[model samples]
Every structure is written in C-alpha cells, then in structure tokens.
Target: MNQIDLGGKIVVITGGAGGIGQAIAQRALASGASVCSWDNAPTAAQATAGIASMQVDITSEAAVTAAYADTIAKFGRIDVLVNSAGITGPTLTVQDYPLDAWLKVMAINLTGTFLCSRAVVGGMVQNGYGRIVNMASVAGKEGNPLQSAYSASKAAVIALTKSMGKELAKVDVRVNCIAPAMIESALLDQMPASKRAENLAKIPMGRAGTVDEIAAMALWLASEECSFTTGATFDASGGRATY
Candidate 1:
C-alpha cells in the first residue's frame, strides 16, 4: 500500500470487528493513526497491540453516546469516523419485504450512522478538523433487485454525507462516502447464489472487489490529502458506476 500519512490522528471505525471495517483498522494503524473499533462484538476484533475496542450498538442512542464518550476518553479525541456498521436485510420484492426487516435495516444502516456522526461532529468542530468516511453501496446508485431495504438505507447514507459535508464546509470536517459494488465478504455470502451471480455480472471486471481495495479508498478519504473533496461519493464499483 502506498503511504498516506494519518499520524497522530484518532480514528473510530464502526463494525471494526470484521470485514471492511477490520481491514481499515489495520490500514489506519499502519498509517500511524491511533485506532479504535466500536463494534457490538468487540472481542472479534483482532487482538492487536495498538487498537482499542468498544462494544457499541450503534442503533441505540444511549449505546452510541456512551461508546463515543468511551472512545474520546480512551484516545483523547476523534479525528476520523467511519460509519461502516450496516446490514443487508432479507432479499425480497418490495411488497413481500417484511416491515420489521425494513425497519431493522433502516435503524442500523441509516439511524446508526446519524447517531455516530452526530456524536463526533461537535468535538471535530471544536478541534477544527475531522474526516468522515461513510460506507455506502453501488446498490444505492443503481438499485439492486430484491434488496430494497439495503438500497434505500445506503441511499440515505449518501444523502446524509452530502448534507453533513456542506454544513461543515466552512470548518475542516470533510464528509464523503464510498459506493462499492459486490464485495467478496460475508455480506456477499448472505446473498443467494443467483442473486450473487446477477450482481457480479454487472461489474465489467467480472469479479467482486476485495476488502483491501475498499479500505485503500477509505484510507485516502480519511487523510489530510482528501482536502478540497467533501460531500462526494467515490465509486469503487469496478466499472459498474456510470455517473
């Protein structure tokens, strides 16, 4: 990985126990940032020497607030926040999608992001610097069939990033998101065989992306080099994104 300095920055990544979140934590440590993972299953995070872990349920207001407080107490401050905690609800047609499932997805994917970002923005503003990298999806850009809840929640995340980015434009807090196509991870394993096949067929690269590739893009967005770019959606769709 090409070096992008994040020395001395404190980064908190939701869902840091696994998948893309875990990959980003590794990268952040390598880049010299103090790392913390706020995951519901904190123990799942790799037992690394430099990384801190907090058990947080991002969907609960109280849980998120307490977790943020714990993070600040442990690291002194938060410089970057990665809202990567989300779940893909059961694949079904709109009419057949369970209301409970829809609500759960919205609660975790969208509401959780809002709570975590809200918790950190004040500190960032006070300190005059911040970076937020939200993990959205290509499903939000081009709606994936049978994944209404997932698509809608991610779409909201993209919009939220835009709004927050503009609101803090005068300050140093930059907010952005990544729209990745089908990635080779447990999230993909959640899909049925046919659904996975259909999604991968859309990528011109003829394959799903790796966690490392997504982490690399996220690392850049969380760095000082990302200055001048905010409220933007970076596409990591492997040639699937046209706009």
Candidate 2:
C-alpha cells in the first residue's frame, strides 16, 4: 500500500465500525495517523494502539458534541474528519415509500453528516487546518429508480460539501466528498438481490468497488496533498459517473 505522510494527524471517522470506515481507519493508521472511530455501536474489529473508539449517534446534536469533546480531550486536536455514516433505505418507489422510513434515513445519512461536520469545522478553523471527506454515492449523481431517500440524501451531501468547501476556502480547511458506485460491502446486504443486480448492471466495470479502493481515494483527500481542491466530488464510480 502506498503510504501518504500523516505522521501527526488525528482523524475522526464516523461510522468507523463499518467495513469501508474501518478500511479508512486502517489505512490512516498505516500512514502514521492516529484514528478515532465514532459509531453508534462498537466495531467488531479490535482497535490497535494508535486507534480509539467512541459510541456516538451522529443524528443527535448532543451526542455529536459530546463525541467531539471526547475526541479533542483524547487527541488534543482533530486534523481530519471522514463522514462515512449512512444507511441505504429500502428500495421502493417514491409513491409507496413510508414516511417514517424516509425520515429515519434522512436523519442518519444527511443530518448526521451535517451535525458531525458542523461540530468539527470550528475546531479546524481555530487550528487553521482540516480535511473533511464525506461519503456520497453514484445514486446521488444519477438518481436510482427505487431508492429515492438514499439518492436524495447523498445528493444533498454533494451540495453540502460544495457549500462548506467554499465557506472554508479562505482557511486551510478543505471539504470534499466521494461519489462511489456500488461497493461490495455489508451495505449491499441491505438491498434485495434484484436491486443489487440492477446496480451492478449500471457499472461499466461490470463489478462492485472494494472498501480499500474507496479508502485509498478518501485517504488522498484527507492528506496534505489535497491542497487546492475543496467542495469537489471525487468519483470512484468505475465509469458510471457521467459528470
């Protein structure tokens, strides 16, 4: 693995317990960055010496605030943030989608991202250095037929990243997001087989992306090398992202 220099960086990854999030944590640790994983539950993977875990419900402002405080107390400062917490709501036409389900998905996928970002930006601004990598999806770029809630949430993430990036343009903080196509992870298990097949068919690569692949791009964005680009969308869609 190519290592990007992150010797003293402290990274906070939301949804860090998940497959992709864990992958990011591992890579960041490998590159010499101290990592803290924030998730609603503990991750199955054991935390190494340079790694820590915190239980946080991203959707709750109070919880997120407390998590940030804990993180700062432990690490002294936060240099990078990876907002990878999200859920793919059930596949259903908009007309038939349940309102409760929609709200739940929105709360977790979109609002959670906003809250976490909001909590960290101030610290980053104070420190005058930060890197934020939000996880968006190809579904946001090309709206999926039966996944209205998930698609819309991601689309908002893209827009949010752009706005935040611009707001922090004058500062050293850079905000960006990734639009990955169907990735082969536990997330795919949430979808029906038919839905999974449909998503795969849309990928020109004729296959799903891997957690490490997405993590690589995320690590690059979180590194000092990503100097000029902020509020930009990095595509990991495998020929699927048209724009």
Candidate 3:
C-alpha cells in the first residue's frame, strides 16, 4: 500500500454502513488508521471488522453533536473527517416535488455535514490539523432531470465545501469535495430501469464506477499528500464530465 502512514491518525467517516462508506473505511484501515464509524444503519458488525461503531442519525443536530463529542472522548483527537451520508431525492419536478422528501434529502446531504463539522471544529482547532472531505455528485453539476431537490442540495454541498475550505485554509484544517458521476451502488437501486439507464448513457465510460474507485480517491484526498490542494473538487466522472 502506498500509504501516507495514517496508523496513529484517528479518522471519522459518516454513513459508514454500506456502499462507498464501507469501501472508504476499509481503505483507511488498510493504510493503518483508527476509524470511528458513524451512521444510522451502521454495519460495524458486518462491514467493518476493527472499526468502532456508533449509531447516530446525522440529520439530528443533537445526535451528531453527541456522536462527535463521544468520538473525541475516545480517540483523543480527530485527524480526518469524510461526510458520505446522502439520499436521492424524489423523482419529480420542482413544482411537484414532495416537500418532505426535499427537506429530508437536504437534511442528510447538507445539514448533516454542517452538524458533524460543527461538532468536530473545536477538537480539530485545538489539535491544529484537520482534513474534511464532503461527498458531492455529478448530478449536482449537471442538475439531473426530475431530481431537482437532490441536485440542488448536492450543489449546495459543493459550494459549502469550497466556502469552508477557504475559511479553514488559514489554519491547518483543510476541506474539499469529490464530485463523482454515476457509481454502482444501492443509492440508485430504487430508481426505475429507464431512469437508471438514462444516467448510464451520460457516462462516457459506458459503465458505472465502482465503490472502490471513489474510495481510492477519497483515501488520497484525506491523506497528508493532499496538503497543497484545499478548496478544490476532484472529478471522478469516468470521462463523462470533460467540461
């Protein structure tokens, strides 16, 4: 492994239950990092073998706050944070979109990042070093048809990553994001076949990206090698997003 020596580092990954979360956790562990898993559906028993698991609903401010505080209490300090929790909003137009679903997606995809980051800011500040990576989507860039709310919320996440990256760059803390194209995961399992195919057609690579691919980029971005590149977004569009 071309590791950055994360053995002694304590890393926290939200949505560490399935899909990319599990993949990222495994990569970090393989590189020798102590992981604290956060998710409502934490698969710590199954997905993670040695990682610490704490079940917490990210949308709830109190829950996320307590989760981070508890993590710090146990790990002593937080070196890396990856916000991977998200949801695919309703497939409806802006006018017909369900209010509840829109808000729910935004809560998990955007507000949850804010809540967790807020909870960890003090610990990172005291430690004088931190790495934060938020997960955005290519949909956020192109604005998927019939998925207005999801696209908008993700777009906000990208903006927030840039904004926070700049604000925290003055200190040792750095923030960034990954905007991935359609990846093969349960996130799209609920969509109609036609809708799913539509997304696949847009990817010039002619196939969906694997969870490990995204995880690899995430692992690197969370490492010390990524020091010079803060306030930036890395593309994982598989040749689809050439612009």
Residue 147, candidate 1: C-alpha displacement in angstroms: 0.4
Best by lDDT: 2
Clashing pairs in 2: none
Q: In candidate 3, what are the lDDT values of residues 193-213, reduced to their tens digit?
A: 888899899988899999999
TM-score of each: 0.98, 0.98, 0.96
Model 3 worst lDDT window (10 residues): 42-51
Candidate 2 residue spans exceeding 4 A from truth: 48-50
Write the candidate numbers in order of decreasing lDDT: 2, 1, 3
* Candidate 1 local lDDT, 172-201, one digit each (tens): 999999999988877777778999999989
- For each predicted model, how many residue pairs clash, with residues at least 3 apart or on different chains? 0, 0, 0
* Residue-wise C-alpha lDDT for candidate 2, range 33-60, written one tens digit per residue: 9999999976656375456999999999
Residue 236: error of model 3 in Å?
0.6
User: Candidate 3, after superposition: displacement of residue 212 in Å?
Assistant: 0.6
